[model samples]
Target chain A: SQTIHQWPATLVQPVGSPLSLECTVEGTSNPNLYWYRQAAGRGLQLLFYSVGIGQISSEVPQNLSASRPQDRQFILSSKKLLLSDSGFYLCAYEGADTQYFGPGTRLTVL
Target chain B: AQSVTQPDIHITVSEGASLELRCNYSYGATPYLFWYVQSPGQGLQLLLKYFSGDTLVQGIKGFEAEFKRSQSSFNLRKPSVHWSDAAEYFCAVAPSSGSARQLTFGSGTQLTVLP
Candidate 1:
């Protein structure tokens, strides 16, 4: 079975600090990866999605960006974090018709 | 652009009672619909989806949703409610023609199960 993993399950960063969140999928190759953010008491918003390595399509204009260096590894990065950047970050991969999600990372910017 | 709407922000249901949550969507063509459940501080879990064939789709955790084309609605329901079922439910939609599988989610409905 395929499984997704995300690093830094919980993070606390100061304002204007750099941010990097990593996501990796095991047991699957060339899978579509996505980054989503959910604010407190709100639904998820799609941020970035990658169909292949070095190819990323941004859904919303934001301070963050995504990169897929390997077939199974995806990274979300930010040069400088903002207070509004604090939220629950989710990593998902497309499987057949549905998408499977990772455990997620909760980042708190103070 | 595709969009989803979950009418209720929060719902309270007594244990063992029947439950129903309303969802509506708008899209240009045939749309792919999905329902996901999220526990506090947890990732969203896919409950059910509607791609084609059946209008009524059965999903995990004993949840079912019916897609009504004329009404432009896909409402989720359960025969009897359980305390464990208390969580936030989200309705999402994606365009069938697009290669991108990104989903547009609604505001979500928070379920509160009464004991």
Candidate 2:
């Protein structure tokens, strides 16, 4: 019964403001974590993935960055948010043959 | 490089009608394929996956897909569509090597069921 949790289901941030979105996994350890963004009515775009603590691979280049502080904790952060950074962010955990997604965080940069 | 392509951006069908969504992938080897459905305000739900052996695989919500190696395609099919089936569908592929779990997703297809 592995479950992934993400906080701040919805957030409104001003441009140039700092951003932080957290994700944690329960019932699973040493799991791979991923961050994805989806625009309205569009497909998901992978942003970052962490295989272990302190190790992160970024798929796209942007103001956003991801960190794995603990075995089951991942954080997506940005020092200065931009208007283009607004989207629905989804955190996912890699399973044996499938991937499980968290509830997700919707950030609106105003 | 590995990639996935879902040609149809949107599809509409009547309830109880047969449905098919086309998916194509470009990979270096016999890739692992999967289909996912996303309902409004919900996370992606795994429908099915194909690794080897059988080309055809069954999934939840009465959905199925077939892998055609020669065509480099994996198309999703359903004998009868339901009203609840109206949602976004994504086709994905994973390389056999590397993480063996990293997936490349298609742009996704929006399925609209007409009652």
Candidate 3:
């Protein structure tokens, strides 16, 4: 079975502060990784996805960006955070026919 | 572009009662449909999915969903509700044949199970 791990289960940051969240996958090789944001009382919005190392695709224009530094490691970063960037951040890897998610990181941008 | 629509914003069901949540999608071709459940402050757990074959698909947590192509709907149902089932439910869709495999999710429906 495959497992996805995300760091800093919860985070609190102020506007204009820099941010970085890491996601790692195990039990799989060269898997597709994705970053999604779920705003309060709203559905998820796709942020970014990576097919392989150094290959990243942005689903929507946003204040965040993603990078696949290693085959199993994906990082979401922001030079300066915004209040609108606050949300539940989810990391997912494409499984056999569907996607499996990580525990997620709850970020509060004050 | 593909999109998912979960009509209900919130629903309240009694424990042991039959439960059903509606979902609809819009796509030009065949789509891969999925339903996921999320507990508060947690990630999403797959409930079931409809890729092809049988219209009725069984999933974890005693939940099932039927795909109605004509109606462009894939509604989720459970024989009986459990208090533990209280959480937000999301419906998603992706192109059957796409390299990106990007899934577009519905707004989601918050399920509130009452005792």
Candidate 4:
């Protein structure tokens, strides 16, 4: 069975600090990866997605960026974080017709 | 452009009661639909999906949804709600053809199961 993993289950950072969140999928190759942010009690906003290595698509213009270094490794990064950048970050990989999500990382910017 | 609308922002039901959550979408072509559940402060979990074939699809945790083309709706239903069912439910749509399969999600419906 395939499983997805995300690091730093919870993060606290000062505004303008750099940010990096990692996501990896085991037991699957060449899978579609995505990054999404969700505000408290709000819908999810797709930030970026990658179909393959070195290929990333931005769904919305923002302070964050995503990269696919390896086939199943995806990273979400930011040179400088904003107060608005703090939210629950989710990493998902596409299956036949559905997307599976990781445990997620809760980011808090002060 | 594809968009999804989950009309009800919050729904409260008693345990063991039938539950239904409304979802509507707008797309140029046949859309790929999905339902997800998220616990408080957790990632969204895929409950079910509809790609092709049968309009009615069963998903995990005894949940099912029906895709109505004419209505442009994919509503989720459960025969008997459980206390564990209390969570935020999201309806999403994926672009049929795209380099990025990122989904467009609805605002989400918060389900509250009362005892």
Q: Could you give the C-alpha RMSD of every candidate to the true structure, in order shown?
A: 0.9, 1.3, 0.9, 1.2
| DockQ, candidate 1, vs. native dimer | 0.76
Return the TM-score for each candidate structure: 0.98, 0.96, 0.98, 0.96
Error of 1 at B55 (Å): 0.4
Report how far off residue B82 is in candidate 4 (Å). 0.6
lDDT string, candidate 1, B15-109, tens digits: 99999999999888768899999999888899999999989999998999999999999999999999999999999887776567888899999
Q: Is candidate 1 or candidate 3 better by lDDT?
A: 3
Off by over 4 Å in 3: none
Order the candidates by DockQ, highest first — what do you get? Answer: 3, 1, 4, 2
Candidate 1: segments with Cα more than 4 A from true spot: none
Q: Model 2, A38-78: lDDT tens per residue?
A: 88755788899988999999998999999999999999999
Candidate 2 residues lying further than 4 Å off, grouped into runs, are: A40-42
For candidate 4, give the docking quality class from DockQ.
medium
Top-lDDT structure, candidate number: 3
Per residue, candidate 3 scores C-alpha lDDT tens digits across B32-100 of: 999999998999999999989999999999999999999999999999999999999999998788666
Docking class of 1: medium
How well does candidate 4 score on lDDT at residue B8? 98
The local distance difference test score of model 1 is 0.93
lDDT of 4 by residue, A76-105 (tens): 999999999889999999878578999999
Name the 10 consecutive residues with the lowest summed lDDT in model 4 chain B: B95-104
**Residues A1-110, model 3: lDDT tens digits:** 88999998999999999999999999999998999999976679889999999999998998898999999999999999999999999999998769889999999999
Where model 4 places Cα greater than 4 Å from the true spot, the runs are: none
Weakest ten-residue segment in model 2 chain A by summed lDDT: A38-47
